[model samples]
Target: MHPQQQLALALLAYAAQRGLAVDRLARQSGLDTAALLSPTHGPLSAKQWHDLWLNAAQLARDPTFGLHFGEAATPAALGVVGQLVQSSRTVGEALTHGAALLPLLTDQVWLDLAHSPQSVWLRFRQLPTELAASATVVDHLVDFVLAFVLHELDGLLLERLQPRTVRFPPGARQLPEHLRVLRAATLAAGPPGEYSVELAGACWSMPLLTADYELQAALLQKITQWQAARPAVEPLRDKIAGYLLANAYLGIPSLEELAANFSTSARSLQRKLQAEGTNYQEVADAVRKSLALHYLKMGAYPIKEISYLMGYNELSAFSRAFKRWTGHSPAHYQPASASRSLPG
Candidate 1:
């Protein structure tokens, strides 16, 4: 299925809760009502999902609109992870297990951990198709991951839920109370998909969350087994993402260039992409889209500067292409809002 279809379905659910009908929103946004509603039913010449959401956000005057679907419903996969975390005996154990289980839920998302003398860093990667859903997916995934771990370990909520920016709507009381319950130290919403916590570096000083290494091992084995049972198809998608990341700002290359980089001919490259259910242009655009978001978060440069930095030749073309990727104009992305929400 087209990843946009999944996003549209999530948006449709969110709209229902806001008392805003999708059909009306579609009309207001100049979206093809049928296409927006049922993109998978037929081939959509235009990317209606992103366009409509952008329009709705513009009309609603909320930059964060369509970025996050409200607490109207908990997505099933996230809920499953939440439940699994709650069952774990300790915070550390829960985190280890949850990290293990991520692949089973969505290959589109991954979590990794690294520690140095100073800090333990948790990083996340979203698949190209998962990029648009980053706000919702990352927010929920981080919160739920912590909730399960902290809940198991401390029997309390997280001390803080800090994001790069608080993208919630005005009078968003849901956030403050949620933070209080979690004991969040600072709940700023700077960027999505990342967070930090204060921790002592001594892993040996910490006790294991559970004494049952055997049981924990068994559960982890089951999760890995489940993941292995699925076809290893998403790795192909990750390869596409990896290629884009390597080439995102190098300027758009022809199929020949891409093929040469892969040590293959253009035909072989085309066949490989086709087998993975994508094309060269689509992958390039996806890379551009992800970079656009990254640049938006950077917030120091003007939109035009960002455009040039992203490899576009002219301001107008960059604006049009950005709109094509994200549905919002560069000027309206509100870097200040993002800045206020980031951690030091």
Candidate 2:
């Protein structure tokens, strides 16, 4: 997929506000400032997007560049999905539309929604390993996404938009000023290995300031047509992972079955996964590891029960796999030690 030109313009605008010129940013990113500003430009590739972010962050000299840039974005800046979100009837509907269109944004991560008895959480799940290679970069990305959501929702429905809480991934270390600068009311870490934003259930049904049933219906039609016309560029790794999660209870499907589901041959599936720097077994193991950690931390399931749920015939097999994945026995991996509750 190509980089959305709207984003390039937004990046330029944000940098300009900070006294960084388009040419300088372009030079650092090896991007054509002219092309990025063109209305007809296609979406940027993953690497191109990464370079643009790094350059902007470096030039801004802000550890939270993504958050800052997100604050500057408007509804139209998000393109089609943004428009749909703007016309939605409620904040919850806008969130639904946002989650559905995430596959179009970046392959690096997809939205994962989790609901607790207290609140509903929207998390970015299954991030690309590369995104996690640097903790600082990941931190910026979390704030960046959350800031964008808040900025777009600003004064559109409520007098002020705020989440019940802002949650970072388990291992992330938040800066002391994160809450003050980000204006987060409640900030904490959760068990997910990636970032999440919590929405108060009470705010979910609030009517959108821009709601128009007739216009929104027409927009929905347009979204359907445009999405079908647009090519899907979601990463295979993510697709496979999603498929596994969807069908996990039935059993971890075989490579052949997965290939069949994707309408391809096993060999081709293997080749594609290989190109993405992963394999079927590796992906399966990763899914099991994530789910296992989730269950163990819940403290409601027995070790043997967790093993069976994860597709292991015996508890020993699951334990071995767990140790291999995290270098600790199931009991030794006190995931709950890090937090009061893990995002389910």
Candidate 3:
């Protein structure tokens, strides 16, 4: 459930431009400003993205905020996906590339392309998650995505797309005025919680104004090389260990909680772990050991405080584990220049 940080970064920039308190928004969303700015930082969890949109909605206090925010999105703000789309030869090709690369932006949502004899349909769907069930959040997100797509289409063609029909979630039927961006199209409510836009079948063949064959080839090559460098699917054991390590300071999650986070039942998760030659306890212990050793070597905090940070209920419990791991007391790892005081 980790989504690329680029979209979130763009949203933060938008919030700042709109005169909202970006710092406060980041804090409310449980996002660290430093991490958000760091190129090495991993993608944000789906919950953080949800919280960010929720907080933005609250702060803006404007029903049309998402629409405007999305309408203003620039290709520069969208990262590689934007650049690749811009370099595509035609409307259809650009959108196809966008759909294919959508996962690189956020795995939570996907863009689908369907065709009939007369029209091409672009569907936007969000995978169901506990955080994704928020109607307010979904409503705005749908608005943002729809507007952004339309904006991109119009930009690529150097002309207004004039979709034959635009469909929105049932909730938007009464707020047609808020969607003036799609005024040329016939507006209709789709399913209770679905969104899509219908464009002329011929629109797919429309040439993009900014198409560059050389640029597209180079971008595609770069993307292919990047994908080749990473595993298609991370091993479950490694995923669990990474999760435990990241959250060890906040207290480790129980097996049930971890299972829920990974969208699996406890039994299923156990089976998967067993198949990977590890179990929940083994992964947790490994993460704890790694963190414990790293913290001890850093000599930044006393052994007692380190125990608490590592989620140990008592210093004796931590000491025993440390002895088992290193065949020595935790104090032996401390450097002479290290401070004895706890971190504030």
Candidate 4:
């Protein structure tokens, strides 16, 4: 999904504030600064967003850049969605409204609220098409989302609203100091691929200081009109791409498997994709290429591990594929300044 341009602009602003070169970052990420600042700019693709974060982290030389960026982010950075959430009557109502209107910001992930007798869990789950398969990209994205949510909650309550438990995805590399923003919450890695914060039930119904019934009603109407005009269905290629990214750990699905998921025969699926001027292999290759480039650009992972991540059983196979995608070998893409060793 294409994320609103405002998010990218906010990140650029944060980078500039930290003494990073925003022009170089924009150039590396294939973004035009003038176009981005223009009122008529369009949303960025999931790949572009991933590239921007990767570039930002590299320039800052900070693995926890996303966490810091989000810690400093304000609701105004989120554009319309922020305004609507701020005007909510209660914390629960704000969260509900935010989750419902999340697509206006980005459909890459959705916000979900789960309830138990004693606590409320706020979870952010990536949509199948969110192409952030690299560990680096996933780490930054998850950190930003979690920190941003906590920051917004604190703003609403006018106090440090500590979560009962803060969970990170397994294999996350955040240091304790980096997570100091989480306050005194119990920190533990949750499921293999999930991120969430558990809040006490008492905080759920707390009134938001910024609540304005009239403002919320007005914003909701405008958002509703905007949503009504959006296309109801995603393109076939995009759907297939999302499926691949979401289930990459299971290995790339076959044409038949993809067809079954969409409730169609393999032949029918092929014809539909062909009508869109591409085939299953083409779409699959594109997803693999995007994933490979993202990991390679980070310069953190070895080529072997990256190949495995791309679902290649043999290093040689992945090497050949990389060569075909780009004129040069993978080594040419890895930055010389990057450490060959992984971070602790």
Top candidate when judged by TM-score against the true structure:
4
Q: Rate the local accuracy (lDDT) of all candidates.
A: 0.47, 0.65, 0.69, 0.71
Cα error, candidate 3, residue 82 (Å)? 1.1
| Descending-lDDT candidate ranking | 4, 3, 2, 1
lDDT of 3: 0.69
Q: Return the lDDT, model 1, position 187.
A: 52
Candidate 2 minimal-lDDT segment of 10 residues: 211-220
**Tens digits of lDDT, candidate 1, 97-131:** 66776664444457666555554444555545633
TM-score of each: 0.30, 0.56, 0.58, 0.58
Q: Output the lDDT of residue 204, model 1.
A: 12
* lDDT score of residue 190 within candidate 2: 75
Top candidate, metric lDDT? 4
TM-score of 3: 0.58
TM-score winner, 1 or 4? 4
Better of 1 and 3 by lDDT: 3
CA error at residue 139 for candidate 4, angstroms: 1.8
Residue lDDT tens for model 3, 158-195: 35667777787666544643446554357778876567
Evaluated at residue 116, the lDDT of candidate 2 is 46
lDDT by residue for model 4 (1-344), tens: 12368878988977865557899999999999998988778888777777898999888887777776666566656777777777788888888887787777655666789776699898766666637446687677767777777766764564567888877777777576344656636888888667788888887788976432332333334334434554546678876775565434334667875664444679999999999999999999997887677667766667876676576878888888989998778888888876762221
Q: List ranges where model 1 is wrong by over 4 Å.
A: 1-11, 23-60, 66-79, 97-109, 115-120, 126-344
